[model samples]
Target: MTASRLPQFSGKTGRPELMVILGSTLTVIAILGIVTFLLIREHAGAKETATRSATTIAQLIDADVLRTVELYDMTLQGLIAAAQRDDLRQVSPQIRHLVLFDRSTTARFKGDILLLDKHGEVLADSSLIEPRPGNFADRDYFQAHVTNTGSGMYISRPFKPRCDCEDSNEWRISFSRRIASSTGEFLGVAVASMRLTYFDQLFNSLYIGSDSTLNIIDDAGILLAQKPYLEHDSIGKSFATRPNVVRILREGSGSFESVSSIDGRQRLYTFSRVGNLPLTVIVALSGNDVFAAWRRTALVISGATGVLCIGLLWLSWLLCRELRLRHQAEQELAQLAATDSLTGVANRRILDLTLRHEWFRAQRSGQPLSVLMIDADHFKAFNDRHGHQGGDEALRTIAKVIAANVRRPADLVARYGGEEFSVILAETDSTGARQIAEKIRMAVQQLPKTEGDELPMTVSIGISTWTTQTDVTLEQLLFAADKALYQAKEQGRNRVVAGS
Candidate 1:
């Protein structure tokens, strides 16, 4: 026969706690993911904004530099046209000088304009009525024109004049055109020089960040001018080997990020080639400046996000703790509700519930269900002699004995009211029920006597079993057990009796 099992609530308290932790974790992760995605997108936007701003500055420089170079080229072309005229030789020296230099635009940084003959001798000077006795055969611009007649509009690397004049120490670059005969023989060169101060003037007017720089370089990778120069005498120096410069020159025009060869600080380099000329304009914006605002914003936002996530987890922990405590309290309440207050055994209500449940199960499985109705022998006279306290004590002792003898978990011992008690034994027939009843009677009979007691305490038990063939209802089963208990009392106290 299969014994019935009691209800249990063990190991089921953590389900709500697990759900709370899992939900909070998922919520925190989702928040972090969204915040991180937003931050990354904002960082990209900051970089793009910086790039566009740099490109704009570079284009502005390109336009201004192209315009200035065009002016110099025009002056060189006019000087060449005048120098090639035989009619100008017959003119007066003053008129010849005026005619040759009339097209030159006067500017603060403008330098001497000279016409050189095939041998690099100064044939005319724009600043002087009579040409200075200066030889230019060694000059790069003069040498370039003489060596290659097709070296159209050669722009020379930065150089200083040989003289010790106050401004001669300043850096200067020359724009020169090859003066050729109709037969294509190189006759001489027309050259004009401009001081590097023109670039400083143009650069200083624009605002690129405090650490950033605006630069101009020749096609040969010679630095012509820089605003806020990185090093002393940086102008006229060759940057041909620098990785950043090489990329800028190779690509001709574009924007990129690279570490500056001078300071080793990263920068965003926006560059453009000045219209058909050998000059490139660059705007190098400091990386720190470009992303400074973004870094500050990210710091604040990340801190806030961290605090939010921590707070959420803390709240979840508190909620889980409360849920655990509540679950424990609920289980304790349920245990108390099912236990007898006086004997610490299954209460009467629980016994009834268990008996009814076992009855249906027994009926379906064809197993016998047994009930043992127990009574304290002479409980009225005993109570009159010992008072209610001693009687209660006797009842507690008898309940403990009955519970000890009924060892199976499916068996229940409960107070049936007054000095009466009851037991439910699952899967036990008449013979088994009678044997168990006799054992309960013997255990109560063996109890130690109290002071002033005439005899040892004892109990009389009556057994009733319901088999598949028995024609009895649940109420009839209980009535039969009660009737047998009366019979046991009538037979003699402390004896076990069985009912049909």
Candidate 2:
């Protein structure tokens, strides 16, 4: 058979394989895209939940801190009021102390309450009946009160006592009221101190995450207190220049996400100013803690998605391989069905199909189509001399020679029957067909003799061509070729003849 007749088999295998690969790839991409989109949305939700939680915590701190400041302010006001009483001077020292320090005892984390003179001299103290001789002329609260007579209650930066007192190293902040005359003349200051541990106690009651922190800073960016302090000495240190602190103070009251300058870990910082006070409370929740659960879920989902997509692709590959194998098997079956087993060329069925197909094609295109009928010479006598196997071998050799001479891609060679073969040459005229038939006849006649064979092999070929002017049908065309083949056998053996 010519290569052109068998072109369709090679091309059919790839279409199924390509379709399978394309479909599998598109499925994998869609799965990944959908998974990625869902994971992104889930991540956003985690962040939003963390933000809301931080905001709630910050609000709680703000409310608590504001209430505490109000208590301290009321205490300072009461102390100032009692100090200006003229009749209090005539009372006993114990009674005067009781009246002046009346509201101070109700304050939580109270350190000391002091009445100072205009020169910042301690006039009376809550810890002492007469008062300590400590001078507070340079204290931030005292200087602030002295500098502005109309200043409202003043809250000082975090500080440690300047004396050798037992708790002198403890951090504290002071709240003071300016003691003034009715004419607004500065008289002195009444100040109260609160331990910074108050913030620790308050923060400990809240359940922020293990890696997160709660913080309080004064308006000056001075670190007042922190829960589970990141830096032991961070208290009383001014973080005014730190980027995160600067943003917190600048925005005054809001929330943001940033990397912590202390540890370089990301955090969600939710902050709010304590009412109108010069204090801000910050709830810094660790990003890892906030998203840990979400990360775990995403990891599991991503792994499963990866496996699913890979499995799908693997299955697709297996299916494509199966389809390729099946197609190859089908092609092999089709080849066997159309081929002569002995000659290894197309069988009679294929010859008839080709003739009919080409007959119509030639009729439509007005092109000449030729058929060559070939017969092995004296096959019956040769078979009796050399056995059936030898006769079959000679027939195979003759079919090969006929196929060799008909080499055009648009031509076909097939076994027409036992010891008879056929060839179809598309668009060939009578002369061309006869020339090919003579070539096939000579090729078979020149075959090498077998070791025990009495005579060499030979064949008779007959040519029949259909042109635009020929009115013969497909059956008549084959009959004419067969008849011409008989005529070639009768005239002489091993010769070529053309049909009328």
Top model number, TM-score: 2
- What TM-score, over all chains together, does every model reach? 0.67, 0.74
Model 1 clash pairs? Answer: none
Tens digit per residue, CA lDDT, model 2, 1-500: 63225423333545687899999999999999999999999998998898888888888888888888889998998999899999999999999999999998788999988999999999999988988798899998888887886759888988887778899989899999899898989899999999988998999899998999999898999988898789869998999999999998999987778999998999988898888889888899999899899999999999999999989999999999998898778878888777788988887777777778788898889999998888888889888988988888888778777777777776888888888888988999999898888888778778899767767788888888888788888888888988999999999878888999
Each model's lDDT: 0.87, 0.87
Model 1 per-residue lDDT tens digits across residues 229-336: 999988988998999999999999998889998999989888999888889988899999999999999999999999999999999999999988988787778777
Q: In model 1, what is the error at residue 14, expressed in angstroms?
A: 7.2
Model 2, stretches more than 4 Å misplaced? 2-53, 76-102, 113-155, 176-191, 218-222, 238-261, 264-271, 276-278, 286-328, 354-370, 403-411, 426-442, 452-456, 462-500
lDDT score for candidate 2 against the true structure: 0.87
lDDT for 315 (candidate 2): 98
Q: Which stretches of candidate 1 lie over 4 Å from their true place?
A: 1-14, 106-108, 147-151, 331-500
